[model samples]
Target: MKKYLTQFKPFLVFISTFFAAYIIVTLLYKFYLNTFETNDVDGITNVVGKNVEQLMDLFNCDIKIHKSIANSWLEVWYNKKYLVRIVEGCNAVSVIILFVAFVLAFSGKLKTTLLYIVFGILFIYILNVVRIALLVVLLFYFPQYNHFLHGTFFPLIIYGAVFILWIIWVNKFSKYAK
Candidate 1:
């Protein structure tokens, strides 16, 4: 029994840490939503929507983003035409939570781990915002490929980036690497 338990210790530790972090972060996020006055748009969703609008404007795309009439989403318009809806799910906080949990489960030195988590979250957030912005433009130009782009290609890009980042951390910075 002792030998069996010892053999599974590392797996247990990783699963425990990942679940602990994920639950804590998800609970905190839920608390934030329950407590805060999100008005029509939640903070993270609003920020992502605004970032997408700003990026589009930078490219002279003439974008407009405002609260959707359907639900808690931001309706994005390009050249005054409805393009896409930016929902709370598009904000990428959940992705960041997953990324953080994985990193914590595979942690290295304390300071390095902390720094990597912060930067990794930032990178994912920025990439998601950009991804949303570009997706809008792509859908506008190529509405024929809507299902393929939104359902398959874009998800692959975001999750693929996360996977690459995980590979880098596991190989370069994780204690498991040593």
Candidate 2:
């Protein structure tokens, strides 16, 4: 039993901690958002819905949020009257990935670990905000390209950024042997 556990300890830790942190952060964020006074839009089907009206008033833009449902997943869209959907739980991915990286910091490399985790968290948040901002802009300017932008480009860019950070950590920092 001890041998079996030790053999898979790293993988176990990685997966378990990653998911645990993901769930905790996601729930906390949901709770926070629900408790906050910020506007929460619901059941939008297209760009002309009440949510878009609110967005327009808030941003002073004639642009709107376009809405779509693909594979049963809702997408919030923005348009020069286009559709947008509210994505409630995507931040979990970044938080889990960050947690995994933080765990790796203690695995074999302790040097610069704390600093890396701090910057990693900051970078994740900033990147997500940028991703949201870009999506809104793209939805406004290029409605026809919404599928590709939402389905492919943004995911590639954001995941690619995270991947690069992970690679830099493992190669340059993690295996540095102190």
Candidate 3:
């Protein structure tokens, strides 16, 4: 038993650190969310919606984002067509949290780790805004593919980017890297 424990010590450490970070960040986010009224959208989601609108506008696309009176989400409109809802999940905070957890688990030097995390979060946030704007435009053109685009394709794009980031961190920057 002692031999087995010794052999797996690194793995155990990684798991514990990852979960600790993930839980703490998630709980903090939940506490932030809880501060908002039931009918009001959280600040992060509101910022994401506004970023999406601005992104689309830069391309001369007709885009408008407004809070939904019927729910806590923001309504995204493209060319006066109701396209999609920008919900909390769409803000990519969860993805950022996941990324942070993994990075911490495989952490390098303090300065490197903190810098990587900051840049990684910024990249994910910007990617999410662009994703939403592109999704709105695509949905306007191909409403029939809404489920695939929203449920599968967009998720794949975001998660795939995060996965790639994780790989880069583990291979290039992590303390465990060879």
* Candidate maximizing TM-score: 3
Cα lDDT tens digits, model 1, 1-178, are 9998899999999999999999999999988777645446788888998888888788888889999765778898887789889887899999899999999999999999999999999999999989998898898899999999999998899999999999999999999995
Regions of candidate 2 where Cα sits further than 4 Å from its true position: 37-111, 175-178
Best-to-worst ranking by TM-score: 3, 1, 2
What are the root-mean-square deviations of the candidates from the true structure over C-alphas? 1.5, 7.2, 0.7
- Any runs in candidate 1 off by more than 4 Å, and if so which? 36-39
136: Cα error in model 2, Å: 3.2
Error of 3 at 145 (Å): 0.8
lDDT value, residue 45 of candidate 3:
95
Candidate 3 lDDT by residue in tens digits, 45-151: 99988888888888999888999988999998789988789889889999999999999999999999999999999999999998998888888999999999999
* Of candidates 2 and 1, the better by lDDT: 1
Candidate 3: which pairs clash? none
Number of clashing residue pairs in every model?
A: 0, 15, 0
lDDT of 2 by residue, 37-141 (tens): 334433212212443346445666554333343332245434344355544444434444555544453344455766777677667656665566567777777
TM-score of each: 0.94, 0.57, 0.98
> What lDDT does model 3 reach?
0.94
